[model samples]
Target: MSNTFSSPLAGRSTGDRLILGLAILLSLVMLLPVLWVIAMSLKDNAALMANPNSVFFPPYELTNYLNIFATSSVFRWIANSLIVSVSMTVGVLVLSSLAGYGFARLNFPGRDVLFVIVLFGLAVPEQAVVVARHQIFSLLKWHNTYQGLILPGLSSAFGVFLMTQFFRAIPKELDEAALLDNASRFRIFWKVLLPLTLPAQATLGIFTFLNAWNDYFWPLISATRKEMYTLTVGMASTQTNFAQSEGLGYLMAQAVFAGAPILIVYLFFQKYIVTAVSGAAQR
Candidate 1:
């Protein structure tokens, strides 16, 4: 009896060890790139060229970071990115939530048809219609402007869809109670529904902010002037120059710069993001 019990306990211990080992291996696999980037950023051009395999280790020099800040327009690019992303996030949150509430609670002719048409926007690729959009922007004489970059992404179909789903999940009794208290529909939405739907708003805000923040292709095509270039666009330009010069350190530093702001924002709002996504899913 002692021998049999001991054998089963040993087997379970072995199984647990194997599971822990696999988890550690997976974590290292995910972390490798981040570690590599940091290593590359710290290295100098000479070190990188002399020992290409030494990318896992720190550089003998910190000139790469100084060179990037001094030579590149990275700060300007970051400012532009912030302006566009924040504007788009605010616009999407307000417009999409209002539209969503209307679709969920209001009765109007052709509302369903309009909602269906808007849903179709989600299926359409931004790249496919970019040429036409550029032409329209040109006709409106808004090219290379901040408004031009931001206006196109202002109202997203996905935002509407996400908000609509969340709004539908709200109890009808709340609306009825507000009505009985002589509250206007607008007031009801502003005072009651909006407060209760904070999670959905946070979910939508983060998604919209990320989309606007990291967008590269459209910004590259639309914003021709260096003054209007976003962080991603600026990073792309830096990559091209670094590629030509084989400056691995500079490339990594630029990447870090581009990614740091978004990481900070996410960290700050991470709790809300989790709550919002979980709540939205239940809706």
Candidate 2:
């Protein structure tokens, strides 16, 4: 008789195999809901309502997705979201980088105390300040404007903290060497230190963009007009009184559509995300 070969997992301990199996089981458990949603989106609303099990059957159609584009102001909302998210991300990066460099590299009066004040901002919940913020924006006539949405998010305490930590982790030798070349402080920061903090910037920028993109609460109050609504607010407006039972497929399609951009961004930046997480863990 021919010799039998061992499976690839044959050498792993029983505990290791059990752990691997559990990991796979958890992954499938998480994945099943997403798959179910996609399936529901592809099914006709009538079929889904008549028999929820119909998602497993074939004859899937894209009619529900088509209806979203045909009827809604989704493209306008998408544009609004992109503008706000991109503008906010750029602003946060610039301000955070400058503030971080100051805190990390320079000596100034009351610097530590000022930094502590910024840290305190992290503990203060946004809900605590929403009323005051809305009133101020109202006074400025900034309601229903892009600036209203973008400006508030730019004061990112977490972004400042992350950048400051990353900057401090860098050796001072680089700054000294740059100074030896007569480089200005701004030049050193722009040319030398900023590039070195790519991982932190990537992490910060991705999170900032995602948060701005999905910002419902602020935009809901700020963008009362249909034309000014962001994707999140716009999608919510599309729901009918009977959306749960009558327009289930359409609802799922809207979710998939609204989330598609975020998913694409994550796919492209996932390597950077992994690098940032792993680097943070090591430190």
Candidate 3:
């Protein structure tokens, strides 16, 4: 019995080591551009211009970070990004959970048809709705407000679909148990099932927040005022640039700044993210 196990382990260990090495190599290949960007962001423009190929050893520069801050409202823009992202995440989670539970567990007229319609909604592009959404918001005079930034993204088909799938995976027996205890449907949803949906919630939250944070086009159109600009919009503005003067190093620094929050959020929720994505894939 001992020889049987030892023989297999010896044979497999070499293959396992090879697979692990390849995984590491693939990871590094994927991370190289990001690493280069970090390196360039730390490098001085003159040094980078002189040695265009050299990013590995940096004559580190804080000039870009300082200059951009002095010239632009980068911090305010970051704050705006955070506000929009957090609001969208929270709104999508709440709306998706409620709607998902209704669609997944409840009986209603046209529920199946309505769900199909909602599924079709996933095929609709944001670009297709922008003009209509803009017109409606303009009519409501919400154009420059946080409501303008957040309300349109409160519920997404993707979020609803994800939550619905997650909710379905949970046994109906839990709901039956709650029902026998005189629990209302809402109580069953909130107390018993919602807790189980955390993985889905994390997945939706991260995706929505990243989408909101990285949104450039809608904010560019809606936020006419500089004060209302989100980070992506602010960064893209003609005046806030390495367009002629600040150069590639400065631009890369801005990219790093824009990416930092989402990176932090992803890191914090990474465990939940993996579970959520894997669960969805299995479903």
Per-residue lDDT tens digits of candidate 3, residues 1-283?
A: 4444453236567779789778889999999999988888887877777777767774687887776787467788878888998998899999999999999999999999999988998999889999999999999999989999999888599988888888999999999999999999999999999999998898889999999999888898899998889988887773444454447778888789889888999999999999987887887
Worst lDDT run of 10 residues, candidate 1, spans: 1-10
What's the best-to-worst order under lDDT?
A: 2, 3, 1
- Deviating ranges (above 4 Å) for candidate 1: 1-25, 240-245, 281-283
Best by lDDT: 2
lDDT on C-alpha atoms for all candidate structures:
0.85, 0.92, 0.86
C-alpha TM-scores of all predictions: 0.88, 0.92, 0.92
C-alpha lDDT of residue 123 in model 1: 94
lDDT agreement of model 3 with the native:
0.86
TM-score of candidate 1 on Cα atoms, chains taken together: 0.88
Model 1, position 271, has a per-residue lDDT of 89
